[model samples]
Target: MTKIKIKESKASTSIPTANPENLKKQHRKKKRKILWKNKVKHVGKKKEDTKAMRVLPPKAPQEFSSNWKTLQELLKQKATSFDKSLPVTQTYSKNHTSKKENVKGIPAISGGGKMGKFKSVNKMDCDPAQTSVPLATLKSERTATDKNSTEGKGNSKEHKKRKNSDIEKEQADIKHKRRKSEEHMEQHLEADIWFDDVDPDDIEAAIGPEAAKVARRKMGIEDKPQLSVEQVLVKEKAFAGLTKAVAMDCEMVGVGPQGEDSILARVSIVNQFGKCIYDKHVKPTEKVTDYRTAVSGIRPKDLKKGEEFKSVQKEVADILKGRILVGHAVHNDLKILFLDHPKKKIRDTQRYKPFRKEVKSGRPSLKLLCEKLLNVKVQTSEHCSIQDAQAAMRLYTLVKKQWEANINAKSKRKCVA
Candidate 1:
């Protein structure tokens, strides 16, 4: 029942502030004490009794005294055994010799197991008759044998030479017979005449004298006199009035879709006189997909040094400017060139009614027209653009007057209407 009042401790109510540096120093000292305690604990305890911790004893130095004594004893024993195994030859005293063996040297047994003594024998006593024979007879026999052998060898060599000579003679005879036979055949055969001999006077009577001379020249019955170098150097005839007309032919290659698309590969142009005016290989802008060589005669190598498409187009356009264009299929060529020309200025051999018998609808190919009207063959295998252009120009020239007259009449009719 007694209640006593006690004072509260002030230390629990207020917090004390210490310097940071001093607190850090005290902390380091406490850490050092802890580390020192750990180090002492580690050093004071004994290490574990492991095999790795045991110390090995040092090895003793080697000595060769006992081994050397043993090796010397083994060598001495080997020498005694080798001497005991050797064979020994027996010796007899002079008093032990027999009287029969005393007449000669010691008798030795040979490999035949016979007791004998080596003795000298007289060579003359063996065969007295062979020695008595004269040396001249033996020399003659040897000489006879030598002569027989030499004769046999000589016969063989001579036979070989005779056989070679016979073979050569037979070959020469055979060659001579062949030459005779060839000469005989040549003498019997007659020369062939390619053409029949047509009388020039008769030819002149049938046609004209000029026509006869042409026929004689073609038949090979007459030869044209060779021209001199000056005549050979003469230039080709200039194209006079046909400056405005040029026949062009284009060769196309395939580019897309199984080579179905046509791309211009080469172009050939000829004047009215059938002389080459312009010829060029045109490189396509797009990659070449096909070379229609069989029909177009344009190979891959032809376009290796070809001009660019734009440059070629410009050159061709400049050449064709304000000129009458003549071709087999002029429209198709213009389409491939991406060019346009006036309808009146274009002369298509394909559409010319006079070239073919069919007046309407069907158009004849330039090759067919050349064969029928111009009497010239073209496009036999691979089409040559230059040859085709020339053929087209020839066909146009053949009917040039009639074609122009018909065209003029049509124009006049159109103007009147």
Candidate 2:
């Protein structure tokens, strides 16, 4: 009965059906699964490689040989040889020998001999009668010896005196020659004038009436009297009304320790004609801390009767009113006076372009500009307010035409714009 059922049960085989859309979908799904497995395996391999590289240690740096070591070894060998050649201990010979030779009549003493033996022999050979001689004879011999010594000493003294006198005379002659040479040099200095190219007549004409008089006196052409400080201030007040431009300068003294705080000590103003219009010493409001005599040239005696600050300020303001102010670093002077002027009317020689060729932005010193442009040496020792003001005015005069033209051109352009 079981055989009959087994014969009827045969293995059944199923076959897939072909559809273009369904086959394409199956192939895509299979490709995706294979790619995902390959990606996972590749990532695991990369992680294992990184772990192996991290576990290893880094290599150490190698050392290099030095060239100086060979040189040092050679030097040490030479030093050792020099040390071996030197004697270890000093020794003396048994015989006593002198490095100098003995005289022909002199006898050499034995090593064990004493010089006292010769001295005793000399004492025994002296005659007793010589010691018993009269005191008159001894005195006469002493006087004769003294006279001979005195004559010899006098001759030597006279010779030394003659030598000293000769040396002194030579020194005096050299000094006289040096003085003459210095005098000659001074004469040459006077002859070689600073402004040789400029005509003295033109300079005389350009100067103010007062300045021309002073120049003439200096040049031995006139005998005009010099003006006093008060007289000059009075004249400046009268001239300020007619003058269109003025140059001013101020000297300051220290009012605090270390000379850090500046206070007005002196003020000087000059017109375009280069004549001093105002020159006065101003007393500081604060207590005087430093006289600064070495730099300001203002001594205690000069400041004894100084004018009040307010009065000086009033006078300066009146003179500078409605006028072109020309100066080197004029801002410092105005600031000290506690006054303010229009910037358009101010001309600073320190900021002038032609004067700043060597230094592009830095302000050149007044002394340097005077020496270079005007061929005049200024501020050689102490500073003088009148001299500085005159220098500023002269510098302005040198380029006055060009400077005024530039200012007018700028004003015209501004108005047009």
Per residue, candidate 1 scores C-alpha lDDT tens digits across 30-141 of: 9999999998877665454344455443233343243233433433443344444545431132223322232222223344535466443222122221112223534565
Q: Find the candidate with the highest TM-score and give its number.
A: 2
What are the Cα lDDT values of the candidates?
0.68, 0.69
Among these predictions, the greatest lDDT belongs to: 2
Candidate 2 ranges with C-alpha deviation above 4 Å: 1-106, 109-242, 358-361
- The TM-score of predicted model 1 comes to 0.44
Off by over 4 Å in 1: 1-236, 240-242, 358-361
| lDDT of each residue in 44-117, candidate 2, tens digit only | 99999888655322233322122223323333443444445545531121111111222121122333432222
Backbone clash pairs for candidate 2 read: none
**TM-score of each model, paired residue for residue:** 0.44, 0.46
Error of 2 at 152 (Å): 24
In model 2, how large is the Cα lDDT of residue 245? 86
